[model samples]
Target: MNLQRFEQLIAAYGSQAHHWPVAERQAALSWLQQQPDNALYCQAQQLDMLLNQSVAPLPAPQLYANILAKICPTPFRDGYFYLCHWLWGESQWQHCWRPALLLGLPLLLGLFASGLSTPSVEDLLWLDLEQSWVLMMAGHEMDL
Candidate 1:
């Protein structure tokens, strides 16, 4: 590989030859051997050494509790469960409405928004065609 590509590979995968893509590994090794005093390669090796020495900090117990609470919240704290209980009073058949409303509301809103948008599909197609025609004319003018 060229010097620039070899430098990019070193930067991306560190100076370790084994970490590089299998296809490019031999080429990279050859390039590195040819230019043994590459500054980028040395810098990458130093950076990798520093990164390997670093340890990740442990997360707090409270963070786990907060994430779990959000994922599987109590009926009293969860808006969907609370709303279902308030309106339908824990009937098994009525609980079906919960999933329907959850999925339908956003879909209905999207349909309403699309209906209210100014540009129709036909209008957008015509606009695209017009832009293409203008570009073609500009290219023709440039040729002259």
Candidate 2:
């Protein structure tokens, strides 16, 4: 890997071989062994033990409680689940895409079609001026 990527991997994964990607772990270990004096690697390894010892995040207790509901069997969510999400809020990421596609695609298509059908905004304004001029001529002819 390049110096930047190596430094990134060192910073993100630490000096531990197991923490590194499985495919690259051996290569990184070898590189570290070959270059123990490398200043970049030394800096990255500073928190290697401390950060690893720190607790990794655990999922919410509510998620595990959902498995219990599977045995109890709750009714499936309906379309109103999304419609009411703005007020109650939603946690799951999978809910965002469907609504975006449903609403955004139609809006995008309408704008695209409007642009395609236009004589253009400038042409519409000029047409309005032409109609006004015709009305003024009609008024002048009526007076004559």
Candidate 3:
């Protein structure tokens, strides 16, 4: 195994092959066989010994009770305050964009849709004027 993987394995499994992941155990064993005096293995052995030492841990007294005492209730925000917060904002410039986008996008899309669907006034008022007449046969029914 490479030095990096060997170091990681040592930290994870400790200089012992049995504790190492089953899939990686053979590779680690072969690497160890190839180099009987691996520096990472020696370091891992030292670290394992350090970890195994019977040091009395400091007592964490009232951990749950301390956390509970430190907790402070916050006021709940409704829609009105939320909208006000978004619009006015802590940074007047930074968060102003989201609210502007929310309002402007719909309005812009509406204008674009209407522009495509609605006919123009000029198109609506335009007409074609045409007439047809016969000179000899058209006047026979008129009263004199």
1-144 in candidate 3: lDDT tens per residue?
A: 676786788777889888999988889888888887878788888878887887897758788667855683334435667777777667767477877887799999999999989876765555211112342234644533
Better of 1 and 3 by lDDT: 1
Model 3, which residues run further than 4 Å from truth?
Answer: 1-3, 55-144
Question: In terms of TM-score, which candidate is strongest?
Answer: 1
Per-residue lDDT for 1-144 in model 1, tens only?
899899989989999988999999999999988999999999998999888899989999999999989898786778876675765646776567766777789999999999898798999999999999999999999999
* Tens-digit per-residue lDDT, 62-116, candidate 2: 9888888766554455355545665344655546765666678999999999998
**Local distance difference test, per candidate?**
0.88, 0.75, 0.74
Sort all candidates by TM-score, best to worst. Answer: 1, 2, 3
Give the Cα error of residue 61 in candidate 2, in Å.
8.7
Prediction 1 global C-alpha lDDT: 0.88
Q: What's the lDDT for residue 50 in model 1?
A: 88
| Residue 1 miss distance in model 3 (angstroms) | 4.3
RMSD of each: 25.4, 20.7, 20.9
Better of 2 and 3 by lDDT: 2
Candidate 1 TM-score over all chains jointly: 0.42
* Candidate 3 C-alpha RMSD relative to the actual structure: 20.9
Write the number of the candidate with greater TM-score, choosing between 2 and 3.
Answer: 2
